[model samples]
Target: MKLVTYLLLGVKKIGVIHNSGNVIDITDIVNTDDMNVLIEQYAAVEHLLKKICVDSDARGLPLADVHLMAPIPAIRRNIFCVGKNYYAHAQEFGNSGFDSSAAAGNVPAYPIIFSKPSTSVCGPGATVDSTLDPCNTIDYEAELAVVLGKKGRVSDSDDPMTYVFGYTLVNDLTSRQLQKRHSQWLLGKGIDGFCPMGPVLVTADEFGVPANQKIRCTVNGEPRQEAAISDLIFDIPTLIKTIGQNITLLPGDIIATGTPAGVGLGFTPPRYLAIGDKVTVSMAEIGELTNTII
Candidate 1:
């Protein structure tokens, strides 16, 4: 089932997505605070969903009735992101004549992990301030985001799937100018409203086949990037397994799988985002995630 974090009547609440485009409030069913506690202990979010499913109130509103927030709104900790996990994206940034000075290199044998400030996460329809900082090069990356259900340390024997809650779409907004200047990603990617996610977070069981999902990204109604999740070099399992071996993966923790090629920077003149540009990232089982650049 799909889960959503929403604000209705000025109160934030949680709910399960209904087939009729409505949202069933599972807030009363699951112990949300307890779920947060479990998350702190690196426990799964699915357990909470299961509880909600078993004991839900009849009170539900149409998805159109509430204001949606990030599926895991107000996560106790920051979200994690994987960078250049796609060979094509790594090649585009390192070899695509956009940054002619850099040399194309071999894909890193290990996952390149990073962090996007939790504050940057916004929900669908949220306005992303492309010009928020003084950076001139605003870029967009479409990635499949994985939400962790529990925490685990990085180790060889770790099973990343056991910690997974579900998946969602993420727009890895970037300030290319800043990125090049510092050679670090934090400032370039951690700006408020940079990581726009969710209309809702679909549970893993509801996500259909993990390897066959279709992922595509479009800007202003035109397709820019398209590929299957199958193309990922550091697939979800590897990512979780690798990352978990080193750090504790907690519930509500997000991991944005790297994007495919065809980003604005990969264009002839290096097309950067402008005021009012719209970016839409979609997947087959997961819902669409759209945001406007301001």
Candidate 2:
């Protein structure tokens, strides 16, 4: 089922997108005002949510009528991100001359991890602010993000999929200038509205294994990034194992699996995002996330 958090008549509600393309408000059935609360109780409520999705009498609102919010607009902590997980992207980034470390080589034996503050999260169709200082060069990275369902430390013997809750798309927006100046990623990647996510969150069962899915990004309807999830140098299981070894994975924790090669900075003269530019990040089965620069 495709789950969503949306606003209708100025009231935010939890909904499930039916196969009929209508959004069924499960707020009454779930009895919760917060999506995070519902997600935390997902295992207990999955059956009921599925039943509501098929109930003909269940009231539903046209998808176009409601404003969709990020699956989890305000997360409890920073968003875990993998940098240069795609081999091609690593080569491009290494050659970009922005990172002294990237100059060493394209592929790293270990995952290059970073975090984006929770404040950066924004929903599809939202407008991103681009007028801030130190953000003259904005870029987009389309990625397939995983949402955790249970609290556990991933072990070599454990099946990582068992810990997954769902999948969503994330446009890992970046400020190249800040990234270079600071010599770190926080200020460059954690700007408010930098992470535009969601249209729907597909449950793990429906999303299946996190491999070989088409991930792409477009700017103003022009294709910029395109690659398969199979290209990930450090796959989901490895990421979970690596992160879980240090920090416990909790329900609703998001891990962006990194982006493919066509980021604006990869170009010779860099095609950075500008005011009025629209970026659309799409992952097969998970749906698309589009945001515009204001």
Candidate 3:
């Protein structure tokens, strides 16, 4: 079932988005409004959630009346992000001349990983404060973010897929100049409000095997990026293995799979984000996550 974290009547609540486009308030029922706790205990609660979804007498709050938050609004730690996971985006970055992490070529031999501070996360439709970028070279990268449910260090005997909770979208905003100057990612990509994530988190069972899902991003309604999940140079399982080898993956951890090509910097003359630009990242199975620069 599709799940969400939202605000209704000035209270943060956990909800299930019913097929009718209304929200089934599960906040009180879940015993904890923290999405991390809910996910960590999902296996124990799945049956109840399913029963609620089909209950004819259950009341659903109108979707239009509530404010949507990122499916997991308060991520427990810095988000694990993949860089240049898509072949086309890899080549574009290598050619853009803003890349500093390339060893020999555009493509990575393994996943290029980085992290965005949890403070960087904002919900859908929230305004992205672009002033944080002194460089004024703000750019947008649309990516599919993986949300982990289980806690463990993935090893040869563990199946990484079992650790997945669900999926969401993240627009990995960047400061081109800072990235080029630092020659590393954190300073450039970890700006406050840089990560705008989620319209909702579609559970793994409901989202199904996502290898073929399409991800598209538009800037002020104009198409900029589009690619299938299959286009990634490094797939999800490989990413989980790479990161979970020693570090214990925990509930509420987000791994933003790298974006596909067609970012603003991909152009001969870059079309960086400007004030009032509306950037939208979408996956058909999930929903659109649109945010405007302030």
Candidate 4:
């Protein structure tokens, strides 16, 4: 089932997307506030969702009637991001000769990971502020994001395939200059309104073959990045397993798997984003996520 967190008439509620292309209110069946207590609640929440199918047929709400919020608008923790996981992205960054030593032939054997401060998170249709400092050179990266359903300690032996909740699109906005100046990725990636996520979240079952899913991004109407999730140098399981090797994984935690080749910074002349540029990040099976630079 396609679950959704949405706002209807100014009130936020949880619901299930129906077959007839409608949204059925299931908020009354499951307590939204209780979701934060544990990951297992997702199973219970799903159980109650079964009843909505009946009620929806009789009194279901149409998709056109409500405003959609991020499947989880206000997740309690920072969003984890993986970098240089796609070989193409690594190749481009390396070939650009911006990092000459890196360009020649240096690639990390492990996943480069970081966190986006929770404050940077924003919902669908939200406007992102472009803090266009004179020294700032901002860029965009489109990536497939995984949402965790089960919390596990880094030492846990279970695989990540069992811990996933769903999938969503992520735009990892960057300030290239800040990144280079600080030698830390957070300075470039964690800007407010930099991470635009979700039209909605698709349950894990709905996104079969998570690793092989196709992903792409376009500026305005021109395609920039295009590749498959399978292109990831560090696949989801390895990423989760590796991160879990030290850091704890929590439910509602979001992990951005990294982008493909063709980012603005990878260009010969460097095509940074300007004010009023519209970007659309899309994946097959999953829907398109669009946002504009301000």
Candidate 5:
């Protein structure tokens, strides 16, 4: 099922995209306006929600009539991110002189992790601001994000898919200058409107194992990044087990599995984003997320 959070008639509601491509508003049956609440109660209510979708009398609106929002419009905590998980991306980043490790031509034995504050979360088609002081060098990272279904520390022996509820696309926007100057990624990657996610969240069963999916990003209709998820060095299972060892993965928590090669910084002189530039990140089975620089 493709789940979504949308705005209709000025009220934000939770919905599911029906087989016909229309949206079935399930808020009334779900008895809440919060997607988090729905997610928390998903297992218990999954059947009922599915029934609502097939009911002949159920009312549904054309997808074009509603405005889409991030699957989890407001997260309970920071977004977990994996960096340099892709071999080629790691090499490119290291060679670009921006990597703190400066380990050019070497892939890490483990996943490089980071976090993006909840404030950075935005939805598809949102405008990303680029006028902040010293933030002139903005870049994009197209990634496939995993949404946790329950809270737990996944062990290496455990099935990581058991904890995953769904998958979505995320554009991990960054300020290259701030990244290098601050010597950390927080200020550079956690800026407001930096994480543009969603169109819909495809459940685990629907998306299957994310590895081997095609991930790509385009700026103003020009392709910039492309790679297969199979290129990930650590993969999803390793990332969950590694991070879960310390932090508890909660329902609604997002884990962005990092980007591929061909980022702006990988170019000869580099090509940063400017105002009015449009970026679209696409992952097969999930969908595409597009945003414009303001």
Candidate 6:
């Protein structure tokens, strides 16, 4: 099932996107308005969601009437991001001369994890603030983000997949100059309004296995990136095991799997984003997350 947080008539609400192409207002179905709360109570919440009152003949609110926000607008902590998880993207960054991770041959032996503060997240249709970077070398990376359901450290015998809550798409917008200068990703990639996520968060059961799903990115109608989720150098289970080995992952935690090739930097001259440029990150099950550079 696809769940969403939206603003309708100045009030924030939680909605279920029905197959009818309308959003069912389910905000009152539960005691809390927080998306994280629902995730924290996922098993119970899923049970209740199975019995929603809306039926086929009854249409709910038209999608155009409500403004969608990030599934969890105010995330509790920093979002974990993996860099160069795709061999092709690793090759591109290796060739671009901006790979600060500076692994032996562009690809690191282990996962390169970084974090983006909650303040950086913005909802779909929001304008990305380009002026934040003085060098103006904004680039877009389309990523399939994982939402964690349970809080625990993944052990050897544990199956990481069971802990997954669902999935969502996020645009990992970056400032090339800041990344190259700082040597680490935080400042360059975590700027406010850089992460444009949402429209809907598909539950794991509804999303099925992460494999076979393709992440495609386009800039102003031109196709820039395309790759299957299975193409990642490190898959979901490995990522979870890598991070959860030490730090205890909590419910509502977000992990961006990483981007594929065809980023602007992959170009010869570099096709950095300009003010007013449109970027749309799309996947098969999840809908497109489109944003404009301002």
> By lDDT, who's the top model here?
3
**Candidate 3 residue-wise lDDT, 16-37, digit = tens:** 9876778999988889889999
The 10-residue segment of model 6 with minimum total lDDT is 50-59
Candidate 2 residue lDDT tens string, 197-280: 897899988887678688989999999999988889999988888898778888889999999999999998999998899999
Model 6, 21-41: lDDT tens digits are: 788887787667789998897
Tell me the TM-score of model 1: 0.89
Q: Given candidate 6, what's the lDDT at residue 105?
A: 50
**C-alpha root-mean-square deviation, each candidate:** 3.1, 1.4, 1.0, 2.5, 1.5, 1.2
Candidate 4, residue 151: the lDDT equals 73
Indicate the TM-score of model 3: 0.98
Candidate 2 vs candidate 4: which has greater TM-score? Answer: 2
**Model 5 residue 196 lDDT score:** 94
- Give Cα-based local distance difference scores for all models: 0.77, 0.87, 0.91, 0.77, 0.87, 0.90
Indicate whether candidate 2 or candidate 3 has the larger lDDT.
Answer: 3
Tens-place lDDT digits, model 4, residues 1-294: 677777888988877777666887766666652233324586766655655654544566786688776666677888889877788788777666444322234455877878898777776777778864345577889989988888776556676688788888889988877776666778678887788887667888878888678998999999999997877898998887887777778888889998999999898789999889998899876677888878
Model 1 lDDT tens row, 177-267: 8767666678888889998988778877778667888789899999999988898988898988877776777777788988898898888
If scored against the real structure, what TM-score would every candidate get?
Answer: 0.89, 0.96, 0.98, 0.91, 0.96, 0.97
Looking at model 4, report the run of 10 residues with the lowest lDDT sum: 97-106
**lDDT, model 4:** 0.77
Tell me how candidate 5 scores on lDDT: 0.87
Candidate no. 4 TM-score: 0.91
Off by over 4 Å in 6: 102-104
Q: Pick the candidate with the highest TM-score.
A: 3
